[model samples]
Target: MPFLDRLQHWAALRPDANAVTIGAERLSYAELVDRASVRARELAGESSGGPTVLCRPNGLAFIVDFVAAVARTGTVAVLDPGWPALQRSAVERMLQGAGPSTPPAAAPADLRDGPSDSIFLYGFTSGTTALPKAFTRSRDSWQRAFATSAAWFELGADDRVLAPGPLSASLTLYALAETLSAGAAFHTLERVDVGDALDAVAHAGVTRIVAVPTVLRLLGERGLTSGVDAHALTGIVSAGARLDGATLASVRNWAPGATVFDYYGAAELSFVSARRLRPGEHRTGSPTAVGRPFPGVEVRVLDDAGRASAPGTTGTIFVRSRLVSAGYAWGDDGSAFARTGEWCTVGDRGHLDVAGELHVEGRLADMIVTSGSNVYPQEVEVTLLSGLGGAAAQVVVTGLADARRGTLLVAAVVEESGPDAPAVTRADLRTAAADLAAPKRPRGYYRITELPLTGAGKLSRRLLAAWITEGDPRVHRLD
Candidate 1:
């Protein structure tokens, strides 16, 4: 059941099949196998054989390097592509926890994080405050996670998978797995350009695409993904965050023939719940209806009593699956989260449907209690995106301290216009958020040309929290 074994198998079966594509570089199955084997041999005696770091730029070399490390060392640590040089240098220093054996052979460090963080994949996940909760995924956990996602997506040999999102993000790992496991062709924009992705699909005759909601938003904004011209594609598997109805409409319109499936998962939990939306059906950005337990996955929704909740009642989501994490690279955080029988969750809150669909509400930690009402920040943000002037694709809602309620919501947005552009205003945001409670409306607006995004390309709410907490002059982009 080893993951990379599939690549070796597929390469043997279909050595001539197109395995991966970058802008000017294409690697067939045989070529990929040959190259990765060579790269792995180059690292045979350099490190602990536990983890190697991947800090290279995106392209043929980066992908080959990561796969090679995973094949030989059984672990790969991925660094952010967008990390500033100084911060990257600091982070690299922190992640150098892996040490080579005595009489180390010649090799540059596989990937550098720093001295104490030899994790295969370690990054910070968003929380309510300015700090990102440290999260790590092991090689074993990632293989299981990718398998779970591939099963839900129903990957096949005929599928041509496109990861329009950042190739570095584990989300794109879904496509990489299919490339090897099922011998599907993997295509992605090396630089994450919008039209380039769509054109890649068309150019490659791609059938299936895996994209996060943000990339889908870009396609909508640029008219590249509307349904009117939907032809070569079969459908898209959406993850990372919930996809709302308005955005789904644009996705469907852009690729009319494609079925846009919604998946509810976190990097920790892997791919837990999913459902394929029929053409006539609607997806309202609710994470809840993500379908029932995946194959071999047992799910439970526990109320405060620790008892299973009614089908429609929301509670913390717990999953027992082959794909669950073995543990973190650092701490014992999974004790309360994972019990006997391999059950664990990333602290998502949602309820089970009568048909057994799993709908995610929000993270339990991000739930805001204002006037004793349990308010989900994501719900309020979705409402604002649908109703408010902040419908721009780059807005992210986060929680901050409030004198009255202890915690309040804040909005951070990106504009094509400069940060001083008058398109977004705190009052306009308030008016658009009127459907939500006064306590839930974002109290401030901060504008940046781009959201402080992680190397994985997820919005860095921790960074946004800092901006909101500082009450920086840039927070008043109201003008």
Candidate 2:
């Protein structure tokens, strides 16, 4: 069944059931569909055949308007609420002066279905250094993903889920749609507040959580100190970034009964691999492992010659699944995607272990070549995070231009506490990184008060590199 059709079916079957709740405003399944139908009809009347720009904040208004546009085949273009002024203005202009306006009514009982491959959403990539690239998604593409992820994660009608990030993010948006498709209640915050998120989970007894690692880390930190019974949560699914060992431990401690899921994928490719982290278990697989490939998803590590690489051999990661986006809608930066028949690769570098588990090396573009050896930053970053223990709040490993080694390995450390935090010296790092090869160790370290984060909430090494090189006043030289 189509994604929206599944939602409509749930509304009729469970009219009084809660569909979505934001702040104090709770909408039943029936009411949400009714409002969305009315808005969709309004949108249909004002249709100029251009994409509908949804730039509203996280709230009922955004949800209803978004559904309404989708129902009418209005070609929804979801923009980040925090977009810079220039990008917002340009996108709005491309929308041909048409905008979503509030209006009142309900969807027809019998709505006709359109071609499944019709462009439904212009999902933008969460790029921080440049304008977000707009990618296209068909109803069928995402619908297949919804079914696959729901079945893989054991999501069902009984799951009361909360996705605490802005719905603009693909991870959060998928969570919202997946919850609705499963006939479950979806909870979101108008703004991301740790206290409010905790209260919602405690008050409504949220059974599952879908958020990025940063949000999950904050929730876990607050949950542990607040003495809240987050044990009601049965699952915590984290994506959009790698989950460090420390954050994983903290999550397990806070939600003793919950299974923590950390996945590594991209916006263009919905889900690739994920593993369940249980209490008392620290290791899921290899340090760089992202777990086994998701059900119905095929993953291969291909070398330069387009042949599958041997196990434990790093190469460009390729994914084949219905979840792959229908390519970019507009900004087609030639290097972003490549195709080999039905299989597609987004330039992520990784390898498969002997157990067939995927180990994310890092992005191909982010790989640093130093002294005739290539280094994947994720490997170095993981080792440093584990070695620094709780003393390092966050650490980014990048390669700087060098006069001799081609590139110099540098680790930018953000200590947990401020400047008074215990210093993590080169000797400490060496001991912590004892398991890794010697060449991967950081040649120098910089202690910074804060780390820049991308729009998707992951640490932004690109921005950090620029800041350090340009002598951005915020970065302190500790080495």
Candidate 3:
């Protein structure tokens, strides 16, 4: 069944059940369907089924607008609320010029049976240029993803999922859709707030949460301090960034009843791989190893020549799956997403271990060549986070302009601070980083109070590199 096609079934089965909740606002399944049906009619009359731009904040309105737009095979371009007015205007203009590829239905269908290839979303991601790149997703791609992930994550009608991020973020939006499609109650905050998230877990009977590692770390750490009861949570889905050992440990301690499932994926490719960490089970071996291929997804590590790489040999990671998007809507600079036959790649570098576990090194663009040796920052960063123990909360490795080595490998460290956080020094970091090859080790280290993050809450390596180059005051060099 299509993603939104399940809505009527859910509404008929549980009309009075809570479908979506953000803060005090609540919408039952029946109410959601009725409101969206009316809104879809209004939208069909206003415009000739053109693509709609959704730029609102996290609230019931965003959800209603999105459901209404996509229910009739209408394409929606989601824009970040944090984006500047000028950037939003430029994107809106670009979307207007591009327009929809396929004409939408003249009126909303009683039960939408749109073709699988019909585009429903135009998700934007930062690219090589100033304007964010747009990618199109068909209804079938998300429907497949919903089925695969829902079963893997153990999400069902009884699960009350909480996603505290903004609705504009793909992670949270997908969570809402998945929860609604399963006839489960969806909970979220008006904004990203650890206190509110913890409260929901403690009081709102939240059974599952889907968020990035940063938000998970915050909720875990703050919940521990505030004595928030997270016994109701049964699952934690971590994605959008690397889940460091410290954050994983904190989450485990904070929500002992919940199993943590960290997955690796990209916007172009939905879900590539995932691993479920049961309670009291620690992730062993290489920290870079994400997990095996997701159900119905094929993973391959290809070298520059497009040949498959041997086990443990780092190469470009490629995926062949029904969950992949319909390529970029516009701004195809040829540097980011590309395809070879049935396989697609975002230039992510990784390898499959002997046990078939995938270990992601980093993106091809983020690879640092220093002193004639190639270094993936993710490898060095992982080593630092694990090696330093509780001394480092986060680490970002980047290359700086060098006169001799072409580019100097360096790292910015966010020291773990608190009564329980262990003390660390430059010497300690250097000693910890000895696990890495001499060339892969960072030549210098800087202390940062906070890790620079993008609007989507993932670590921004580009912004961090700029900070080092521009000598940002927040980043201080360590001896």
Best by TM-score: 3
lDDT (tens digit, per residue) of candidate 3 on 1-479: 25567888888888899999999899998898888777767666666434788898888888888887766456778889888888888888888735552233334346353577888888988643388989988888988888888999999999899998888888888888889888899999998877888888888889999999998988888998889988888999999987878899899999998999999998889899999998888898887889999999999999889899999998999999999989998887767899888999988998999999999989876788898998888889888877887678888998888999988998888987778876667888898899998999899899987778776667787788889889898899988
Ten contiguous residues minimizing lDDT sum, candidate 1: 108-117
Pairs of residues at least 3 apart in sequence or in different chains that clash in candidate 2: none
- TM-score of model 2 vs. true structure: 0.89
Q: How accurate is candidate 1 locally (lDDT)?
A: 0.65
Candidate number that wins on lDDT, 2 or 3: 3
Each prediction's TM-score against the native? 0.79, 0.89, 0.93
- Model 3 clashing residue pairs (backbone): none
Ten contiguous residues minimizing lDDT sum, candidate 2: 97-106
Give a tens-digit lDDT track for model 1, residues 426-447: 6666777889876677766667
lDDT of each: 0.65, 0.79, 0.85
TM-score, predicted candidate 1 vs. hidden true structure: 0.79
Over the stretch 1-479, how does candidate 2's per-residue lDDT look in tens digits? 14678888888899999999998998998898788777777776776656778897899998887777776344688899788888887776765633223222234653323358777777876654466677877788887887788877879998899998888878888888889889999999988788999999889879999888877887888898898789789999989887777678778889988888878888888788888867556684567888889888899999989888999998999999888888875667656776678898888998998889898878866788889887888888887887777788777887778899988888888777546778776677667667778788778778777667665566677778788889998777664
